[model samples]
Target chain A: MNVAVTEPVAAAPVAERNDRELAREELTIARKYIGPFPIVMAAWGLGNLVCWLALWPLVMTGTLSLWIAFPLATLNVALCYLPSHEAQHSNYAKSGEPLRWLNELIGYVSTIPLVLPFKTARITHMDHHTYTNDPERDPDYGVKAANAWQAILTGIRRRQPGQPNAYGKLLREKAEAGDETAKRAMMEGLAQTLSFWAILTALAWSGYAIEAALLWWLPRHIGMSYISLFLSWFPHHPMNEQGRYRNTRHFHYWFGNIVSFGMEHHIIHHLHPGIPLNRNAAAYRELRPILKKRGCRLDGV
Target chain B: MIGKIVQTIGPWGPVLFGIGFLAPLIAQSMEAMEIAAPFGLSFVQTGLLIGTGLGLAAKFRGRWI
Candidate 1:
């Protein structure tokens, strides 16, 4: 019996097929959670404003104590970073929509307490996500590589004159390279920095220096330090400039997850930047098997 | 009913406790600033008691972390 020879169909490469599957799964999961994120952002953003308004009168009237105000203000300021982070990802407003103006507005307002220019921060943070753990490329490397104390000290040191660090240098280089986005970011950053100093000077000139120092400056430092530790040092430290999974760590503890607004899932974030913060836990669960199979490291509380 | 109450407060339990715990120090600071203490109650003692109560509730709620 003569059997006709049949041609075997060729299958796609295993790695390519797996990557496509992973992308599809991530997209589906991300789409499910993206709608609610803007609402959460608005709630938290407005909450921060309300807290500031309530506390500001008390602060001005000397009703709110430094001990209380410090922690509360610090927490508020730290929380502000989250909305700005969401805006940075264009997740605060829907993508390709007119409401994107709201995202930029929210980003700028949210970062005001921290004295961070939204444009500059957004660009630098995007770079951080793109080049995580890269000593040369990541704007966050100096802070991430240092211990908490060192990170704090380095932050102080970097603020001094003639002490341009990696981030600043990169910003300057990008501006010099005729990058319009970077140029606008640098201009905004400088303008915001100057405005902050001008306000502080005016405060001192008007004899509210003590109040400014106690209520504003101190809390900003505390908030900055808190963010430095949680976002930079804890998530990326002790990891080399390896590819995504190997370089970032995930936190399983609820406290960390809540306070960080689900940012504790840094590895998942790096692996899937499209996922919103509110759904990070769900995404983590969905991707946990894949992550484990890929041997990703888990860290932090 | 108790489980429902615990479920209702959710993660806010610790946050409320934390606020209550800070109230005493806040009261003292207000006193130093010559702000009149509200309601004639000892803010510190009151804050501590409220904090402890919330802390207990939080502990019961199992969301204190």
Candidate 2:
């Protein structure tokens, strides 16, 4: 009669043991934020664009001071991308839905001043989500760098003549394959570029160079850099891992959420793209426990 | 033809890109501020800048392409 003994084994940590349970719990919480049509985003899309356009006339006619118009221009250009971004994901309404026109309309018009074509942005953005830290595949992978200057400089470097462009290559491939949407994106992109140069050149010749430079030229460059810095680089720095949870990070932005464009919750956006930009913070708060359990890189939570 | 011109420019591609973008920017700034074009050839500068821009833009697939 031999005595049998239970094998000694270590028990899993509390959070580790409850990972599955927490995921299910997290989904329940996330579902609560799915939608009721965020009208605020629509207002932001239309309002910011109208304000950006109005800058031209106001400054051109000397009705408003360039000193004041400059800052507003930067703010408006930076603000323009988000609403279109929301519309890019069809956050307002799904395809074929009755309100879908509003989504398309907002997507197209909101980015006019920024000189980005919505279809181009949407397609490339979808690719970005699919391959966020994958150097070989992501159109946005060009922005990955060790620091702010590197990331920003890389953006400029990649735009230099004869440099390889990930976005362009991908769009070209898709368009060559006869994807109608991609073709439209390419055309719109060309059109936007011509329009930007034409307007700037025309204004310069017309004696409104200061107005053009302050209101659009400088602002667009600054705005693009700022967007690349916060949206692309900060949220996904050291962009090494490709795992869903590990690819993106939530870090403390000392500048606080608003000045940082609410990007501290960008990890939440990557995880749940359907959540409107404004709701990511609240959802992140509720889903923190599960994210931690999932071994995500939440630095400042 | 633009692509050929771009290739002919060779290593100066970026230089052209810079000049093409900055020439107009500077020329106009001078005009707006009522300063001279340094060479006093504002119209000549204008034509060259436009020509450079069109060349850069032709066969352009993306930014600075």
Docking class of 2: acceptable
Residue-level lDDT tens digits of model 2 in A1-301: 0222233322454366555555456566666686679888899999999999998888877899989999999999998899999999999999999999999999999988788889999999999999999898888888988888898888777655678867778898998899999988877886787677767767765667667778887888888888998999989888888988899999888789888888999988888888888899999998887788788888852
DockQ of each: 0.02, 0.28
Please report, as a residue range, the 10-residue window in candidate 2 chain A with the lowest summed lDDT. Answer: A1-10
lDDT of 1 at A258: 74
| lDDT (10s digit) by residue, model 1, range A132-170 | 887788888777544657777766655433345566567
lDDT of 2 at A229: 88
Model 1 residue A206 lDDT score: 49
Interface RMSD of 1: 17.0
Model 1's DockQ?
A: 0.02
Error of model 1, residue A195, in angstroms: 1.0
The A-chain TM-scores of all the candidates are 0.84, 0.91
- Give TM-scores for every candidate, taking all chains together and pairing residue i with residue i: 0.71, 0.84
